[model samples]
Target: MTTITQTAPLGDRTVRRIGFGAMQLAGPGVFGPPEDPDAARAVLRRAVELGVDHIDTAQVYGPDVVNELIAEALHPYPDGLVLATKVGGARDERGEWVRASRPEQLRATVEQDLRTLRTERIGLVNLRRQVGGPEPDAVPLAEQLGALTDMRDEGKLGLIGLSTVSAGIVEAALEITPIAEVQNAYGIANRTDEPVVDLCREHGIAYVPYYPLGSAFTGGPRALAADPAIASVAAGHGVSASQIALAWLLAHYDRMLLIPGTSSVAHLEENLAVDGIGLDDEDMAALDRVAHLGAPSF
Candidate 1:
């Protein structure tokens, strides 16, 4: 099968713009192995078959569950597919998420990811900063970025990225090191990262928006699925609402990359089909109106 033309340059590496996020491959509670191992394997394999050349995962995602599945499912990984993973987070004994950005912990996590992914070096290692509380008092952002910078120099990492970060953090990171990509939570219902997306565009860096289908909003997935505006637009194009959401993102920014995660092969194929769903002027305006109906602060 011919590969899709969805790749964008991240420093020296080229990765598919519409990539796959492996978070959903984990089990219930998203803290352990998947319930259906064979099904998860089929999903990953189908993603590759559908022209997905970029796969995003994190050690915190299962704390190792998703990456291990990735290795098991795609050992001897195909050439030209970029496998991006993140560090700086772990899980507690009870499978709760924990932030650990200490230099040693960061180093150890990278080493663990390398081993789990069965690769000498990670194609992209996003330094996922902690959110949802008071600022961290551990190592400074510069120091953490410096550690990754050193790793990149040592050929242990091909590129570096930042996840769930702000413009100020991006500025600080750029001062100490080069950032190849930035991952943030953005979608039709969530505009908290719009400024961050603009910054990436201005700097020519890839802006990957996680939860591109409107996660964490008050209406939830069901609300998004039933949005009258989205449904109307989707009907006009004979595409799914999910595809309209993704296509709008692809048209919203040239530097934008999408990593919608799924555990079903059918859903994976449907998500990839977004690449071929084009938006017209009227549809774009309709989407924009609904996207800003209850937009959040950036």
Candidate 2:
């Protein structure tokens, strides 16, 4: 059977491997406030109650909407809770993601997060790069790290992280500062970021897959939870396909910390129940084959 430890060291703190992502707490398009603010708050509280110590969010998510919700839901955050937010971007009037990786821009963004999050300091801040990847001409990766480093030095941020970046970018950033974690679009079927994952393991950095359940945003493919292989495995285990997908991630990487997001208390509880659902060698083998199972593997 493939078993995984429940907690992993994140900087000085150890958080449950299955954490919470605050992106979905916002409204559609990740813009504006959620339709049901009370319901969203309930999900956040329930996650913590279920022992989710790592919460990932960003200032750009809902253009400060999610951060505000987090504060409203879980202010005076419980001890051991790690609040991770992303920088280097923002939402425009049309709710589109735009790069703001300049050093000054990053500094301003971190300061803004402190205000909205209602905290003296943020636990983690990932420098979310541009869609097409890093452009040296726009703003060198070093400059972005420098901006974050300065804040880290001043005690405004606990540990620096990176998102949507290449292994080369991680290498470059390492020379400037120690990365506590890396968040990217990775899942059982979407194994394109394998190289980055290998690099993270080499350096002891925690790997957090943003869409562990897969996403429709990535070229509008079917959800990974709907994959035939995953569904079959779920049936054998008598659990949701979502649980099988998340369990595979934990079993696959010891350092992986999942931040699967949801806005409902029921789904939140279902996600938290992923712990102790053992996946045997046969199940692991079938899931391991998901990445190469033809088109729309999800």
Cα-based TM-score, every candidate: 0.92, 0.94
lDDT of 2 by residue, 132-229 (tens): 33454268888889889899999999998998888988998889888999988888777888899999999989999878777534531245656788
* Residue 182 local lDDT, model 2: 90
lDDT of 1 by residue, 148-187 (tens): 8888888888899998788988988888778989988788
Residue pairs in clash, model 1: none
Best by lDDT: 2
What's the alpha carbon RMSD for model 2?
Answer: 2.7
> CA lDDT, every prediction?
0.80, 0.84
Q: Candidate 2 versus the native: TM-score? A: 0.94
